[model samples]
Target: MAKTIFNTSEKSNFILNMTEEQYSKLASRGLIASMLLVPLFTIIPEVTDKASYAFSAGGLAVGGVICMILALIGMMKKYIGKGAVIPVIAMGALVLWGVISLINGYDLNISMYGYHNRGEGLLAILFYFGFFTTAAAVKRETAVKTLINGIVAVGILNSAVSLIQIFITNKHYQFVSVDDEAMAASGLSMSPIFLAMVLTLALAAALIGFVTSESKKRRILFICSAALFSFVIMFTYTIVGICGLVFSAAAAIAAVFALKAPKSRLVSVLAAAVPAALAVVLVYAGAIGNITSYRTYDGRIAWWADAYMRASASGNFNSDIINIDDPVDVYTYMNEKTVDIIQKNPLTGTGPEQLAFPQVRKVNDLTEIEDIMTANDGIFDKDYNEYLYTAATRGIPSLIALVLALVPALLIGYKSMRKRKSAEAFTAFVLTLSGVLMFFISCSSIAYAPIFWAAAGTACAAIEKPKKKEATEKSANKSVKAEKEAAEKPAKKNTKAEKKA
Candidate 1:
């Protein structure tokens, strides 16, 4: 059976060098990547990026996170005894919000099942709860490398698909998720924003790998992977995504310098950071391509301002809509319209996923405002600002609650990085930070949000592994051995003395 499984065609070198235990350990380590691969490669061919592909992929990834967290908990039951309480309380906020939405909420149907083409509702929040649970429950430090490997593989596959789409098909393909920004980048679930988030995390992991790895071949592999992820992020062209790579690279290199490792490893981190930095400067300066939009800063500010206005004041926007060419004009009007909504519904504002929908919009309960919204048809589905959007839809406390939930994991990863020299801890810290930052630019999608959530959990899990403990044990063993040797020397000396007498 072993011969059949291993392919007997290589008869000349049929003997295996690895013991069964070694092989088993190798296969076990691959489990995290194996489960993640199901979602990484899954794409519903018929729908493309419209709906089910993203939803299904997200569901699968969430399931995988849950399964791994449970398995890790079982393996480390004693480790979680005292640690599990805080995580449960932190994550239980999701259940609280979900129950409120179900029991006494506006439009229970929409709350339970989010609006069309968007699945970020009660269900999505619960899945996130699962992600935080992983962070709270997991104790395994060995799985960090495997998780990073899975992320790198997904990012590489994304870049490959995008390259093929850009060159061969002329920016038209359905193999991976495609969007209007399909020409910008492809593969995985989103266009520029979410795809950028995934690639950003991937680049961070690769740089971390470069910092941690000692072997020449493994170091080269990590640098190459970092380069590949950077190239894809360049095509993304979004400000946050591009800047994320540059800043995260700088941070990683700086972290390596701070680590006890030889200053020589900083070269690999620099190798990853320089090309990405150069690209950002050249492209913005019009050396690579005429992407004037990035240079003219007014456009993005106006875009975000418009989203804020839409989310904050659903009523006033339809009838008294002012021309938004001037950023100052839009900002002034947005502040005017949104204030009343906050004053009225401070505790639980409107409902879940109800932003920019006329039928369910509760920005103002005035009859005239309702008529205008119904007639005009609210077009903006998302506020593009998650902080304000969350406060507006879920209320101010909900947003605060969400932040509080993540605080523990962030703190855990941060403490680990500061107290000890662990590349895994720093990588998780940076990834979670990036995820939190991405919210300012875009909303969470099922496709890429898991990466952030998983990172948070992995951050909590970056404790000292058993090997470090064993090394300390070896030190203790050395003293005992020395004492035994010392006693034996006296016995041998006395025997010699007796023989001489």
Candidate 2:
């Protein structure tokens, strides 16, 4: 009988076709690109000013698009698996909107709009791609730590550079209003929004480190770094960032307590007091007005008031029922605008490129601005609202697709809570919670699509446990084969010995 040789090339081909590792690597690269792009975008915005926001919707935004492309390719090749579906759905919706905007634009014409619209749609799609891909590629627990560490490293470097620049230029003092010499001063920095986002990432990572790290050295370092970031955040006076941090801390404490994590009573007491401590800091910093508003929680009531009034007038009471806070009202107002736009254009919405156009038009006719006076409010021009931006621009189908993509990831996160002991599960829990916060804060935050995709990937990676019995069975089979071969070898040796004798 002739011995057969296994085809190594065929096995290699099979492995190459099946492994998620390649997709993961690409996903990590996408994340790295996004982080680097953040600072670069800040620099460009500072220098050019005209094209500052463009880079955000351009290069950094394109990262999400590329990620979606890679994810689609991976799915087509069968390497993506179930984890890729959410991103694909998000990307699909974005692409559909992009196509629609190119064709059925409601008289909003700009040579740059299509380019920017596609870019925006692509950007949102790419976020999901990078997020999901990272989840698929990296080990669940390790990826979360890596993401945190990466954010911390970026925050530290950015903060240090800003400090050094202020020192070197001898521009130690700056004014917030450009005329108020008595106002608080800070180093060279980007807009409040970008600064807030970085600080938020750093804060989240620091909280995670404080809770999970075993090393005294790392714990100390995290504390110092967190304090520095918090101080910087306050100096920036980005109230939104401060609010996010407070919420995250509250979330961390709640999660820890619920999990019954091993910790001292002192630690638990401190955790319980965190919100109060944060309020004190906010008051001491002079960032807030009227501390009693904090007690009644009336300080942030404007958003809900705006939402309820608008919803009541629109007769859209269903969406505005949760007017308990400014946050809910803000979310309702944003989503309602989108819901309104979507009712008109359900198939594609407004098109990815025109995300802000419809909202802008709804509020003002730029050509007729002199007649309307609505443009005087400035909010219509800026379009800080997310739901309105998406509905007016990307349309409703894209938003629906976005919701579908995110909901599954949320389910996965919910499942992860079952594994309360695992670090990966905790990270997913945090991300899912963050997504929820972002949703109520503004639909635009979750509407990015990429965040949700990443959330889904993290959820899947965290919850999908390996079966120990299957692994044991494989090990047992290999041992049995080895013993049988050994027994046959002795029989062959005896036959040879008898033949020689």
Top candidate when judged by TM-score against the true structure:
1
Question: What lDDT would each prediction earn against the true structure?
Answer: 0.56, 0.48
Error of 1 at 71 (Å): 7.7
Q: TM-score for candidate 2, please give it.
A: 0.63
Clashing pairs counted in every model: 1, 11
* Tens digit per residue, CA lDDT, model 1, 28-107: 34334433543454444322544443355455445655544443443334333243345445556755765564444466
* Worst 10-residue lDDT window, candidate 2: 307-316
- Residues 208-266 of candidate 2 have per-residue lDDT tens digits of 56666677787677666666666555444434455656755665565456555555422
lDDT of 1: 0.56
**Candidate 2 RMSD to the real structure:** 9.2
Overlapping backbone residue pairs in candidate 1 total 1
- Model 1 misplaced regions, further than 4 Å: 1-42, 45-51, 54-58, 61-65, 68-78, 81-87, 102-110, 170-182, 268-270, 273-344, 358-378, 462-464, 467-501
The count of residue-pair clashes in candidate 2 stands at 11
| Candidate 1: residue 443 lDDT (0-100) | 62
